[model samples]
Target: MMNITIKRIIIGICTTIILLTIYLLVPQVSNPSPSYETKLTHGTPVSDDIRAMLTPSIEPKRTRAIMVMQDGKVIYEYGPTDKIMNGHSTRKAMLSLLYGIAVDKKLINLDKTLSELDIDEYIPLTTQEKSATIRDLLMGKSSIYLPASGEHDNQITQRPKRESHKPGTYFFNNNFDANALGTIFIKETETSIGEFMEEYLAKPLGLQDFDSDNVIMGSPWFMPKKKTMHEQYYIYISTRDFARIGSMVANKGRWNGKQIISEDWIIKSTSSHSDLSNNHINYGRYDGFGYQWWTASDTNTIWTDGYGERFMIIDPDKRLTLVEQNFTGNSLLSSGLWLMNKNMDSGLSNLMKAHKTLAKNK
Candidate 1:
């Protein structure tokens, strides 16, 4: 009995140490310390109808954070904009921004194929799959479709048979495309995503709540059971920081009297290169796809969204940006979805009402 107890204690200690080591290996970030409201400056106030949308929902159904900006000023905010959360697939849009800069610097060529870059996956890429170009990946038309690191069941199941369609011929959003793009970015720029993000975005934009701790050099994470050759470089940004990014995008990639990315790149990146109409998507939500951004089904507005309601919506014509973040405190799918979406629509509409600077022709 004594020997068994001793062994059990030793095993428990070893298990705890192993868990700690794994946790340390992967990057982790947290909410603000001494958490305070992220309301920096209030822009033009809105009417009561719009104010109602900015108000938080009841209890666990409420969102964690949201911010709206018009013409580089914060019009309103709800919850702690300083709160940090996984931007999830929204990182794809962020990568789009970086790619714009990289392309401007002649660091990468969109037409460059995976074959030319020598890109590969754990499951191995067929010669046909390797023919997909960086442009195809950005447009989510790779159609290479193999199980990737961040794939969920739906993604894996939705994948058409490999090589079912030629590169840039069909549109299918897959992790392999985004993850491989991350690898290609690192290889071409010879800079870690985190470092480049800091130098190009956070510092230049004067982001208040930017944190670099969760910036990993590889895929968002690694799993022993699931192996993938490409690593996903996830960007962890705050709601406020997201608004800055959206605003920059809305401003044609210009910030603070400086051209961060060429106007041409921004136009190309946000334009609907891939039309989703008549696609098999049952949801039938999005109308079109740009490099990484999604277009509103009814409006020309550009937006990017991630899991758990992390969203950044941009309307260059109106010069408006709206950002929201939630740590799954509640979901739009929950019973409260209608209410949340209603408020979101109202808030965004009011923000756009504040400034209607008609965008020039793209």
Candidate 2:
């Protein structure tokens, strides 16, 4: 009887192991999301003719990845979408997202003066600088031009003389505003940018790359002085994950059926606060500057740019989100004697043209 019992027990253990292995190996089907749309399914890319049309501009040697999503699904993709690349200046847009959430929760008021927030640089803020509001900073109108932490070498060289312009009057793309805003965001929300981003965005949006360990975080790369405060808040994100960010904004801050960010904030933040038509070549016909987001003259569209030729163009009118990144060299100046460090906008421009054609056909 003991031998029989031992054999049965061993068999039972084997059976349990086999069952557990089977469960682990099989793909589990998750319950459908409330706003699940059959049309939003992936794997079926756009037609061959369209791909051929896009290949020349998008699949060059230096190009890393290009993903164009229509109606929240990948319509065309070139290169590896899983690769995480340096975010550069595009990190400002992500900070703006955090600001939206904070503002929505009434934790930070846009109109609050810098003085009220106790924002001051080691160089000391002028009375006019202290009077600049958070909204002015977001809009790049905080005319308080001191030696800013993380201020770009070129931007520093171009920095308007200290206290030259008053707050909310001029629009200069300064790293100071972005960095200071980041510092303010952390202080007000009592959360690190990485934690807020991972919790508020990555996890909820089902991002494939960069979990808690590798989530987007800030680093002090552009700090010129040892005593300087705010760091250049950097975010390392993948192409596909950024497409999701674009899609989220394109939907006016809605993800699936849930309202991830308020539509009012999206509209307000994306609307052009500074007119950049005469300057900034990146903006289209009537495009201008918004709160960290570059506003297109075209209705219902926002453009986010990264230094060295990265871009995320979100067009709500066409239900499209396009992302391109990682240019090893400027193809435009590769053969030229002077290969300047200028950004190559050809890929994105070509993509925009293709998008317009596709939208018209649809």
Candidate 3:
């Protein structure tokens, strides 16, 4: 009888161990962090009325996520809040913010020219291209006509010949300019841009979804010839974290009362530096170019939009920041381009409508 009892106890223990192992192996859906206030106690609650207004505007399959924050609190959220998505060109805005901090710390000089830094090791820059200053590149006025990788826009790839326009005179939203700026940023700061951002911006801003591992550095697929330049770089982050970055901009570089980035830099970077009204690449109405940020001519809003229907729009006047993420596909060169464009148009229209609705409700 004692022997039988021992066998039964062993069996029970083994079963318990197996069950515990199964429980441990199974994935658990964690509760949202307490830092993020999902409750609508802070600002105007995203009421049923608002949801009804915004729901019809969204294309469910095309838009992966949307997050809207008002007065530094999340007023609305949709889709998986934790979903990580490629930042695409919207990463340029983060780079711009880093440039602001770098400038504020006197680590970078805006007047620095390409020639002085010897930035043309791969394909020697012409005298005019070399004359393009860091400021000009930041302002999207760099006239350097080098073929840029990862750029799907026909306007830039089929643009005029090199040195057709003087540096700082004309504005073309070219990836070559942004890539060159990234190179310059690394050379001047004596550290990788991603490392700097992770240390300074991401940490201080409390970006829950950003990891330094997500920073991709290398050449874009289109430009195989430019091996030395490594022109294409991107950062993958969640829409919620993107909203946090936008909120920082909306609050004039202040996050939780701490001056994360200088307010002066924010003002300068978001201010209109180029007139993009006549440009064929339509970035909605009242579109203008700033320091890697898009400015609206009609409203006091600054935004960064990516190729794959991802956007972070900040309206300082309204104290609002909206971030949208839509994953079209791996490559913009594919048939996904049409869907991407459609998604972008629909998303922007809905966001604007929602903003108007919020204003009217308030």
The best candidate in terms of lDDT: 3
lDDT value, residue 159 of candidate 1: 76
Task: Score candidate 3 by lDDT.
Answer: 0.76
**Deviation from native of the Cα of residue 15 in model 2, angstroms:** 52
lDDT by residue for model 3 (168-277), tens: 99878888888888888888999787788878887788777655655667732333354547366777777787888898899999988899999999999999898777
* Each candidate: RMSD: 6.2, 12.5, 9.6
Q: Worst ten-residue run, lDDT, model 3? A: 27-36
TM-score winner: 1
lDDT of 1 by residue, 1-362 (tens): 99999999999999999887665443355543322223345568544555564564453344467777777787777787776666878999999998998888899999999999999887888988999999999999998888776677467777788889999998887888888889999899998887787677766777676645445555333335357778767677778878888988889988777888789999999998877876666424578898988987465688888765566778888778877776532121331353355432223343334323322311
Q: Score every model by TM-score.
A: 0.81, 0.77, 0.80
Candidate 1: the clashing residue pairs are: 219-231, 219-232
lDDT of 1: 0.73
Residue 69, candidate 3: Cα error in Å is 0.6
Error of 2 at 357 (Å): 1.5
Candidate 2 residue runs with Cα over 4 Å from true position = 1-40, 57-59, 212-227, 278-286, 298-300, 327-346
